[model samples]
Target: MTEQKRYAILPLIAIGLVGGLLSGLFGIGGGVIIVPALVLLLVMPQRLAAGTSVAAILPAAVVGAISYAVQGNVDWTAGILLAVGIVIGSQVGALLLSKLPVGFLQWLFLGFLLVVIVSLWFVVPQRDSEISITVLTGAMLAVTGFLTGILSGLIGVGGGIIVVPVLMFFFGANDLVAKGTSLVMMIPGSLSGTLANWRRKNVDLRAAAAVGLAASAASPLGTIIAGTLAPSMSNILFSIFLVLIFTQMLVRLIRAKKN
Candidate 1:
């Protein structure tokens, strides 16, 4: 590689490493980190950054998912069912994105996040033993997946925030399992989305590749730590994470309005 290219690639790797850590720690796809880093550090446009971020998420998801699976935290059937629904719902979300007003969607998302935050904060999380995959459970997971996918397509997030809480509250999954299942569900959708972005020439392939490789290497460490944390602690941490995300999004939306 050229000298300048090597220097540029270093930052992308750093971004990926951090994103990967968050991904493993919280079951996110890490676009939240990748998108902003590409935009600010690489001076990429927002659309291109979003597309490239999707590509960067692929490896992190894979590594994190495997790590969680090894720890017995992943529910394969739930993840698969969610993935199927996400694929279908993403298309609907993309269609809705253009039809809905920007402010309306932004408000809606923020409100939903707020509700989730409140729910996670106050509710006593379910025990791990309570988790089971019945037909009805699978159906509920699919519905959650659809909502997750719609939010992903509409707001460009991985929807782990939504998924984790839903799994914990409604499906009786523990925090680690909820995070793991969410990570597993992200793999297929991220791959598909990345390919679409590549087809549209929206990805910075070189930078994204660097990010993905580095993220894959670092993600397992995060999963290890997450597995060790107390369930109550994990729930609190997850709730706090959602608050930060919500605050950032809300600020950005307000600034956009002022502009």
Candidate 2:
């Protein structure tokens, strides 16, 4: 008898559960987990994995964002402004994904995470500070969103990692509010990116659905947990999470190079 393997949903579900939990707790789109898992565990191509991951983030982001909104942590004006820029930027990124060398993306991802982790230790956000919506600030927020969206499309991220830190560190927003608003910004960003990926035949709907449903189901639990943690502790834990991911990817890259 010959042993053969085909598609299975179990791994996808397992990946989704972990990804969703972290997404809610850290206010990220879970692409950090999904993209690598798809590429390493499922033997997916990097570009395709990124595209599928973006598609999956849509549903999970919606669920997580609503949970945060229920706690009154979301900023509608700031989020909307960010979304407008993200909508246009996602298309630009999606276009770039096909043209740019995939190796460059790995470096970009690793570098950005390092910068964010370092930035977190120096910044402590107050829970009471909210976004002061001035015209200049709004324009800055939109520009921030546009740049983040481009990276999101290229990397299959939901933009929360960058957005959350930028909101808390630069905008003087509360940690929770930054998280909630980042989730909200991801909704349109993911949708727009997913559409572009779909047109490029980069997305696999079956895989996306499997991962997304599992992630959405688990997301609220993470949101509930996030509310119980202190902002300082949350930043510490998030930094640890990023470190682990960074290490994992580095190890994988080393192994790939050795092969």
Candidate 3:
């Protein structure tokens, strides 16, 4: 490997170690962690970081989904619907990255994350609840996935930030089911977005591989931990995580403003 590539390896692994645990535990693609780490630590441009994060997310999403599936936490039918919508929507989101300004996307991302954090505090998580999908509910699920896919592509999140909350708050799914299904839906969306980003020359393959592999390796452990946590506890932990990230981003924005 080149000297520059070698230097990037350790950072990628460190970021992935934390991201993978979050991905498996929360059913997110861990892009929230990966993107910022890339942008703030590696000094990468926002769009490129977003694209690389999506690419790195795919493997972790797949592993996390499998871990949940094995425990029968996944709602396959709902997840499939979400996946179909996200696959198409992710392409559109990827297109937008090239068109929109980076500062706009960054502000938009932080705004959205703040909303998610607030919602998590108010929404009670169900551990044994399940989704009852009718035709209308199915349609809504698809729509949710479509919107989340756009966010994932644009913000480099795995779409779980919205999907998990929506499933729990709107669809009456338990936290485990929601998280598992979120991971399942992310697989296609992440794959589709990564390809689109790659075609646009936005992906950094070496970094993605380094992060993706490490995240995948660590996700199973997180899956096991998720199984042990109560739904209420999980929500609280996730909320705390979001709060820290929100603070980090806020500080970054202030620094940028000052500069």
lDDT string, candidate 2, 26-108, tens digits: 88999989999998799987888899999999888999999999999999999999999898899999999988865566677
Model 3 quality (TM-score) = 0.93
Worst 10 residues of 3 by lDDT: 1-10
Point to the candidate with the largest lDDT.
2
Q: How well does candidate 2 score on lDDT at residue 83?
A: 92
- Estimate the TM-score of every prediction: 0.88, 0.93, 0.93
Rate residue 128 of model 1 by lDDT: 48
Put down candidate 3 lDDT per residue, 1-259, tens digits, no spaces: 1223333689899999889989998888999899999988988878889999999998999999999999999999999999988998899999998887556666877787788788777887667788998999999999998988888888888898779878888899999999999999999998899999989988888999999999999888888999999877888888898888788878887888899
Instruction: Return the lDDT, model 3, position 124.
Output: 73
What TM-score would you give candidate 2 relative to the actual structure?
Answer: 0.93
Q: Model 1: which residue pairs collide?
A: none
lDDT, residue 13, candidate 3: 96
Model 3 spans with C-alpha error above 4 angstroms: 1-7, 102-111
Better of 1 and 2 by TM-score: 2
Q: Where does candidate 1 stray beyond 4 Å?
A: 1-7, 92-103
